[model samples]
Target: MSFRLTELAEADLECIAAYTAKQWGEAQALTYTGQLTHAFRKLGGTPSMPGSRKRDDLAEGCRILAVEKHLIVYRHHAGLTEILRILHQRMDLLLQRLF
Candidate 1:
C-alpha cells in the first residue's frame, strides 16, 4: 500500500517549509520536513493504521493523522493512499476548504 502526495499536499509541504524556514531557520525547516516525510512513509507501509480521526465529510475513506502539531489528511483507494494535505492543527480545515 504505497502512498503518493497530491499536488495540493506537495504545495502544502512547500508552504510549511517556507514558513518554518522564515520563522525558525533552514535547519528546523529541513528537520520538520523530514519528520513529515517519515510519517508519509509510515502511512505508506500501513495504510490502515489508525489515524487521529475519520473525516467522512471529506471523502469516503478520508482520515487524518497527527504528527506533532500538524494534521496529515489522506484517503485510501484502490491499494494506493493519496495524501490530501498537511495543515497545522490550529488551522480551520473547513474554512480552508480542505473538505
Candidate 2:
C-alpha cells in the first residue's frame, strides 16, 4: 500500500518537527518525525493491523493511534492507500478538518 499526505497534514508535520527542534533539538526533532513517518507507513502497510487499534472504525476505514501525547488519525482509501493527520490528543478533531 501507498500513502498520500494531505497538504494540511504535511504542514502540520512540519510545524511539529519545528516545535520538536526548539523544545528538544534538531536530532530529537528528526527522530520524532522519523518515528511518526514510520508509524504511518506501518499503518498503511497492513490495513488489517490498523483495525486492532483501540477505538478504530473499520467501517469508517480509519484508525487512531497515540504517539508521544499526540493523536494520529488516519484513513485508508480504496486502492490500499491512506491519509494521515497528526493532532493534539485533547483537541476536538472535527474542528481540524481540511478537506
How much is the lDDT of residue 33 in candidate 2?
93
Best model per lDDT: 1
Residues 1-99, candidate 1: write the lDDT tens digits.
489998889999999999999999999999999999999888887876766578877767788999988999988787787899999999987766453
Please write out the lDDT profile of model 2 over residues 12-84, one tens digit for every residue.
7999999999999999999999988887777677644633353343235566777776777777767554555
Q: Global lDDT of each model?
A: 0.86, 0.72
Could you tell me which residue pairs clash in candidate 2?
none
Runs with alpha carbons beyond 4 Å of true place in candidate 2: 50-59
lDDT of 2 at 57: 34
TM-score of candidate 2 relative to the true fold: 0.80
Q: In model 1, which runs have C-alpha deviations exceeding 4 angstroms?
A: none
